[model samples]
Target: MSAKVPASPRFAYKGDRLKPLRAFCQTARLGSISRAAEALFLSQPAVTLQLQALEREFGARLLERSGRRISLTREGQELYELARPLVEGLDGLDGAFRERVRGLDAGELNVAAGSSTILYLLPKIVEAFRATHPEVRLTLHNVTGAGGLDLLRSDAVDLAVGSMLDVPADLSYEPVYRFEPMLITPRNHPLAQKAELELQDLSPYGLILPPQRLTTYRLVDLVFQQNRVPYTVALEVGGWEVIKQYVAMGLGISIVTSICLTEADRERLATRSLARYFPSRSYGVVVRKGKYLSPHARAFTELIRPALFEREDYYANGQSER
Candidate 1:
């Protein structure tokens, strides 16, 4: 007789039909059998059996084992990518389907955003969302620009809000707010006295910049490169606030969004608009193409993009990809 299928407590719907796929996906995501088993509430042996069965069916090795650590092979990576959304759809069916029928009384919404956007732009809107949808759980994940896209693709976050100068083909971005880019210096600096400033004008002073991986840094690099301007980096820093703090102490000057500057900062720091030199920075909502937004998610999107969902009946019909 054939060996009996191991009992899987995590998903009980289809006997052992989906257990292998589930096991492989969890293992891929968590990067270890023990952790995947812990997450699924199953023994390590059971999870291993499920993975072995999956590998046998595919006739290809799925996981590259290294002691206790694990990684996906190329084939395994493709399969995991193909299988993840299916597994997530299965896991989130109740919430997604119930929101379809019951109309968003309770559900979870995960949003990813850059640090500054979360700190400055989202507080009031988040407050409104909390007051309006007390039953729904909303989480704001602090992710960088690239990390946000990864979260969206993995279904970890429902949507993201930030600026994007270059958007991927599989995603959509809607501009919400625009802010002028400004150059700031210590109150006593000479450039601060000028009403107009150009990229070449600030070339002399060392600039305090964010890490190169971030969009802001790239934009600055691109602009400088195009203008054939030579600038020195006084210091490398992260976050507008940190850069601002250093500039206040006369460590170096920095370019920051006008959104970051307040009247209080005006007294301590000298600011000149770089709108002529740098393009206006636009921040917005970003969502993955073709993913269905729950009613609660849609409602929050509407709060961000009032005109996009102004029809009042868009959610009544199913989501058509934007």
Candidate 2:
């Protein structure tokens, strides 16, 4: 019997066993193994293996895959409901505690913003912030409108800076900058010759629009609908740069934020400020409702709006930062 002592298991997971659940939760929240890996600073294979471990431990498939998209299964949803808050709380605990114990000298700040804002808006502000606080790590997520808001909900990002046409109930938007809208056309276009362009003037010409689901298309739809104007769509493209290129090639004219009109863009196309036709779009910071802000987040946000962090005694009041 003394010779029959049981051998220890060949494999072992020593550190926090909850890690598999944490990786699984981030995968569920972001719906992509690659993205979850990026968020966790782990290899994609590591995240995939952790997910496999979770599914094997529970004896169920936790995820479902479409053509290119991954979604949570019913079992996955149930687990996520219980696991998301735990993972967020555990990961956020360090930043929250450190900021309270010390100050803005340390901590991490992650931000999400749309492509237009990343390309045209954030360079200088981010440079200024980094110059002031090189110790604080800053990451800017270049995501689309819908994707950025989704990242905000999962606590993957501390703050999101972009334009919002429709604000969700669970999110708060604070406008910081207003930019005029401009119509872009080839210099030879008949409409481009007009000193003043009207809604009716656009009816006959082909219009290049962003995809229908995006807010850009929605705003264009609203303006045309209000004026009872009928328009033709020549093409539906994704980025402002591509749209500009097509317009330059004489595909069709497109409306864009004036903030994107660089001198280089100006030489290729003519622009007329359409402020009279469309209200200036606002770009601002958005945060989750009832969320806590780390000192790093507060310091960076205060840079965006001096009044934003001034009123909130984040430690004492803890009143909603929204």
Candidate 3:
């Protein structure tokens, strides 16, 4: 006698039954029914049932399970490729429509930015964006430059702003601003009286440098190395704020991006321009290649474009004319 097969659940009609396409796509992409279930907020058995239903509908096994792991078959891979975008598009549409109905100006905007940009640039932009779109939810992930780049690559945030040492081939960058670096020292330091000082002249002072990996640190290093000027590094900190505090306490003099200095920083310490030429560091926006920008993201980018690009042009042309 043939073995009896287990009965599948009966639906009143195909139209009334929820299509398991979404669940099937999730499982195939994630490679685990449990993970798919957690992402979709469904029970593990329910996710399995959905996948089983999908396989039945297609008349072939979509996944092969071994122990606790899963892998898609060839046919499953093709089907998943076709279905993933459709399901993701549907999800995007639903979110867009709900946000629209709530209000044209309402929805969350997530931004990832480095600490220096957060201190110097982000507050003004955030205030302006909020004033214009008060109903919109805004979130910021504060990170170092490398951390922000990692977040962008991992799809953790919609946008990031910071100083990128080099633009990755997989990412796009737009210059937001460029500012020269300045030498910072304690208020009573002897170099404070000079309007500008050469790099060679400061070789004897203890330096508080950004960690060696940072773009700013590399830029400073290149200038000193090329000139064969040796300086003592007394401390290395990751963030500009920490570097500034250390300088204020007389730990060491440091070279910092001018944007990182504020009125208070100047009052508490002293800044002098470098007599030797060093390249200006650029602050900019970075986005993952081919990521779709929502309406709010587009608008925010537009609002910031002038501050990033046009103002610099204005300054450049004005200086030339003068």
Steric collisions counted per model: 0, 0, 1
Name the best candidate (by TM-score): 3
TM-score of candidate 2 against the unseen true structure: 0.62
Per-residue CA lDDT of model 3 for 253-286, tens digit only, reads 9987777766566467877655346777777788
Candidate 2 ranges with C-alpha deviation above 4 Å: 1-105, 305-322
How accurate locally, in lDDT, is each candidate?
Answer: 0.80, 0.80, 0.76
Error of 1 at 17 (Å): 9.4
Worst lDDT 10-window in candidate 3: 313-322
TM-score of every candidate = 0.64, 0.62, 0.65
Q: TM-score-based ranking, best first? A: 3, 1, 2
User: In candidate 3, which residue pairs clash?
Assistant: 176-308
Model 1 weakest 10-residue run by lDDT? 313-322
Candidate 1 C-alpha lDDT tens digits along 1-322: 9999998444342376677788889999999999999999999999998887777767799899877789999999999999999999898999988775754455788999988888767776787788888888899999986788999998899899888888999998888767777788898887876655668988889999999887778888888898899988899988888898899899988887765665467567877767766887777889999998888888887676553233223211221111
> RMSD per prediction, one decimal?
14.0, 16.4, 10.5
Predicted candidate 2 versus true structure: per-residue lDDT over 209-310, tens digit per residue: 999988878888899899899998999989998999999999998888766666576467877666767777787889999998887787777676543233
Off by over 4 Å in 3: 1-105, 305-322
